[model samples]
Target: MRMRPLGRTGLEVSELCLGTMTFGTQTPPEDAHAQMERARKAGVNFLDTAEMYPVNPVRAETVGRSEEIIGDWFAKTGRRGEWIVATKHSGEGLKAVRDGAPISSKTIPETVEGSLRRLRTDVIDLYQFHWPNRGSYMFRQNWRYDPSGQDRAETIAHMEDALEALERQVEKGNIRFFGLSNESAWGTCQWLRLAEERGRPRVQTIQNEYSLLCRLYDTDLAELSANEDVHLLPFSPLGAGFLTGKYQGGAVPEGSRMSLNAGMGGRKSPRVFEAVAAYLEIASRFGLDPVQMALAWAARRPFVASAIFGATTLAQLEHALGAAEVTLSDELLEAIDEAHRDHPMPY
Candidate 1:
């Protein structure tokens, strides 16, 4: 796996990050460990997880179980510092986390302490806020998103408060660098401006959904990333299993994400299948595995620091890792461009 620099921190991360949100829920502990070992062998030195993980069926009791799994892995392997460990603090709206409250000045320190205990580490390499407290367009909220009533001054105050809390975490040695997720370019600029004004550490990376099907980060976020040196840690780079051609004939394929949430969180639609098929056909024409094409496309994006991906089983993990070596050619990319032009905003 190739390594990429994470912003201006001088920290090198793997091009493909091993995502562990499936750890305690869809996957058993042993299998999770096995997948970690496989990823390590493959030279992937970055691991990403979050506090409210194992999220397919997020439950109050199993909220922090994913971190516990990682802690166990570190304890058993005794190689805690061999790789870069990145995790996030859950923002408001998730019922099981912090009583479903938003992140604030009072919450950061305690959240850092809890994450440290569960991760079996004294420090986190990259600490990220799962989303903004004042809310932004993400998780398919774009459909009904309206920023007309938002108070810019109040939002900046919250951003500054959050930055102060993050700065405190940095001073306490709990978190080295901070990141943003599900954020817009304007929101990112607000955080950077606040940090610079206060002489605090600016946000470094962004974790947003970017895939063949979802190009939300392409225009504005791409500019922000390239210009500000903010890196992209794209999650669900496969379009939540749609780009893999698994749901082509309307088959949910037992135990897939579709089996649990049939709507795939509003991602499933009439146009989505045609878009998936078009990309699949291009991959086949180029003699490429659709999964490989999907992953490679995300990884090769100019501003992408790393693509975050997860697998439910060992076989699935192996299939995803295989994409690490495939490189998309100009012909394949042109075909994909044509497909995109023919069908934009499928969902």
Candidate 2:
């Protein structure tokens, strides 16, 4: 895997980041450890997780189990320093954590401590707020998104408060850099602006959903990322297994994401299948693996720091790692663009 700069933080990360959302749930502890070891050997140095994870149906009982699994791996292998780990602080509406509390000054310190304890690490490489307290347009929310109810002054105050809290964490050596997830362009700009004005830690990355079926970040957020150097850590780069062609032809394989969550987190739609078919056809025509094509496509985006991908099994992870060597020809890229024009906002 090639290394890329994580925003302007001067920390280099792998082009592909291993996602651990399935580590403690669908994937067993031994499998999770093996995946981490396999990824490390494959040259992946970045791992992303969240406090409220192992989600194929995120339950309160299983919360933080993913981190614990990773911590076990770190303890057993004694290879904590070999990778740059990134995890998130759950924002408002996640009832499993802090009773659905929003991220604020009160939450940062304890949250950081909890993650540190679970990960068996002293400091986090990238600590991300899972989402803004003001809400976000991600996760298929764009269709009905409304910004009219937002309070500008209140939002700015929250950003300042959060930044101050994050700065304290930095000073305490609890976290080295800060990031955001499921945030909008305006929200990201405010975070950056506040950090600059207040002399707090600047936002280094934004982990949002970006894939062949989801191009929501291609416009204003893309522009902001390019101009400000707030690189994107795109999750679901394979469209939540859709782009892998596993969900094609309306087949819901047992133990698949769609089998567990019928709606696939609102990613299921007739158009989504059509979009997947388009990309799969392109891959078939070029004699390429669809999974590698989708992942490589996301990793090759100009503003991407890393394309975060999750694999429920070792076979899946090995197939995904092949993307590191599979470069999209210019012709293949143009074909993908043409298909995107034909089927935009698939989900």
Candidate 3:
């Protein structure tokens, strides 16, 4: 697998990051451990998860099970230093997590402590705010995203205080770097500005949803990511299995994510299958798997540092991990471009 720099930080990560949000929910612990082992053996050095994970139907009961699964692997294998583990702190508005408490300076230390204990580790590689405390446009929240309620002065003060706390964590070797998720370009720009002004850790990456169906990160966030040294760790590059032809033709496969979370986090639509069929047609024409095609397209994007993906089974993950080996031919790329133009945004 190709490795890329994580923003301005010297740490290099695999071009494809193994996402573990399905660790404890759909996947049993033994299967989860096998997936981790397979990913590591397949040359993936980055493993991404969140404290509020195992999230097909996120509940208060299974809040930290994903981290605990990884913790078990670390405890059993004793290879904590073998991989770069990145996890997130939950933001406000997710009822399952701390009643959706807003992240602030007051929330940093305790949140980090909780993650540390759950993961059975002394330090987290890249700790991220799962979502902006103020609010974010991710997970199909864009149509109703509003910024009128935020207090700019209070936000800046909170950022500064959080930076100080993160700096202390860095000094104590609790975290190597910091990042953001479900954040906008403006917020990221301000975080970079403050980091430079105060000599604190700049946001190194932003985990946003990017795929053929969801091109939300292609415009403004694309420019900021390219210029400000913030890498884009795009989640759902396959559009949550929609791009894989699994949910095409209106056949909701049993045990699929859609069956669990009906809306698929605002991804369900009549047009989604139509778009998937178009991509699948292109893949079939070139003898390429639709999964590989979607993944390669996301990986080739200029601003993407790593394309994060998840799978419920070892065979599925193995197929995804091999995407790095399939270099799309120019002819295939043209076919994909044509398909993308035919269907712009399905969700």
Which number leads on TM-score?
A: 2
Over 1-347, each residue of candidate 3 has an lDDT whose tens digit, in order, gives 88889888898888888999998989989999999899888888998999899988898999999999999999899999988989998987888988888787777888888888899999999999888777887888887888898999988887888889889889888899999999998899989999999999889999998998888898899999888889999999999989888887677788789889788888888888788888888889888888987897897788987899999999899888778888789998788778778888788
Candidate 3: residue pairs that collide: none
Which of the two, 1 or 3, has more TM-score?
Answer: 1
TM-scores of all candidate predictions against the true structure: 0.98, 0.99, 0.97
The collision pairs in model 1 are: none
Report lDDT (CA) for all predictions: 0.90, 0.94, 0.88
lDDT: which is higher, 2 or 3? Answer: 2
Comparing 1 with 2 on lDDT, the higher-scoring candidate is 2
Residue 340 Cα positional deviation in candidate 1, in Å, after optimal superposition: 1.0
Least accurate stretch of 10 residues (summed lDDT) in model 3? 246-255
Which portions of model 1 show Cα errors greater than 4 Å? none
lDDT at 197, model 3: 100
Residue 216 of model 3 has an lDDT of: 88
For candidate 2, write residues 1-347 as lDDT tens digits.
Answer: 88899999999999999999998889999999999989999999999999998898789999999999999888888889998999999999989898999999999999999999999999999999998898988889999999999999999998998999999999999999999999999899989888898899999999999999999999999999999999999999999999989887879999999999999999899999888899999999999999999999999899999999999999999999999999789999999999999999998
